[model samples]
Target: MPLNRTTHRPVSTNALGGLYVLGALLALGVVWFAEHWLKLAPCELCLWERRPWWVLLGIGIVTIVLPKRYARFGVFLGLLCLMTSIGLAVLHAGVEHKFWPSPAPECRAPAFHGGSFKDWMSAMPARPNKPCDSPDYLFGLPVSMTELGGLYAAAVFVVALVGSFRMGRSRR
Candidate 1:
């Protein structure tokens, strides 16, 4: 199913922006659930994988507080977030699969690793990469990190695309 802001409401003004927000919340909740409830012990790779969802969530928030006219732009932002999430997740999955390499330089990249000692300290758990991109949890059949990442990305995409219904109007 395509991501929509919220499909439950009447499909006219497409004010059902809740879906986008919910999508972002869901993504955040997944991370939280995995860490606290599921005890997934996110590796640096897992944290990296979540960045895009976080971005999408941010856009969702703006969509909520801003004008309805901004909903379409929010949708576009959501799409960007999803695509980025998908790309990152794919790369993360590759790292997990050893399709390329682990301990991605992002953990230490000049591009990403540029930060203070506290930032580095906070990021330490994620550093050096987790021992094989293994999911800390197994739902039914040995759940994969890649699967979760893709799931969030797909949700973000849906929210963003659906936001399109509210496009091109400035709040009157």
Candidate 2:
């Protein structure tokens, strides 16, 4: 059997699964950093697309903490998150393409910058249009919403897949 670098246990499957969560988090961090630190304001749909990610991040942390016996369940959870993010990314891409206007009312219009208690209490800014649909291209392909969304989803799926292999080991 292979030797474990840390605990010296045979590198149990559950530990590997935990690492999967960790890796996925790191990947997400990069995306987060790019968005927040770089001041790249996401469109309403982009923010909405991130909802599953927020949820999955929570689940990923919990999955790491839970008993190893539930590792398979965690894998499934990851898969669900992966699928959700992918779909949203596609929707964002669609919005960028103008194939269909963003269903979000916010994206349909502008924000309200009134200077009054009543104005502040009034209807807020309708979501503004997406600033970027194809800001940059990678390998001759535009870094449009759909493409990036698909890539992020694929990464999450891979991590979950790797995690899955480790799940069965602990249930034994």
Candidate 3:
């Protein structure tokens, strides 16, 4: 296989673009399956974590459609999105492990003071917020979904970084 001249990696812009798209799809698919098929409830943090993947998906589609010269920029954008995802996942995992309190207000219990029972009930959200600390497992694995997401995001970030390096080198 032909290797990149500068980075010595065997990846091309097209492959990297496809990786971005596939990675996003796989992550989103797993979460969807866990939620719909496995009947796992996602907390506020979990929902927040999904946003980056959506962005990555859009970036991937654009990267694939754009010319090779412009694909490097898309890869860079994807790296940013992956970084966001990793940060959110780490935050969520910390909440699950009790390493620190969740930053999300929705993760906290609602406080009611001096309100009629009927009024409080009416003011409550239609669906009660899922507790952020509760760990959901897939296939009986010890790792929580949040941790898994972090690992996946980090891996993709590293790969994309290498691929982008190659892209930059090839331009020289």
lDDT of 1 by residue, 53-147 (tens): 66766776776677645555666666777788788777777766767766555444343358898876775554354454564546766657566
Each candidate structure's count of clashing pairs:
4, 4, 0
The lDDT of model 2 is 0.62
Model 1 spans > 4 angstroms off: 1-16, 106-129, 162-172
Q: Residue 8 in candidate 3 has what lDDT?
A: 74
Q: How many clashes in candidate 1?
A: 4
Model 2 clash pairs? 106-126, 106-127, 107-127, 111-125
Q: Compared to the true structure, candidate 3 yields what TM-score?
A: 0.90
TM-scores of the models, in the given order? Answer: 0.66, 0.65, 0.90
What are the root-mean-square deviations of the candidates from the true structure over C-alphas? 8.8, 7.0, 3.4
TM-score, structure 2 vs. true:
0.65
- Inter-residue clash pairs, candidate 1: 3-158, 4-158, 5-19, 44-126
Choose 1 or 2, whichever is better by TM-score.
1
Write one digit per residue (lDDT tens) for candidate 2, span 64-126. 677756745765776777787878777777767777767777665446675887786566554
Better of 1 and 3 by TM-score: 3
The residue-level lDDT of candidate 1 at 170 comes to: 33
Better of 2 and 3 by lDDT: 3
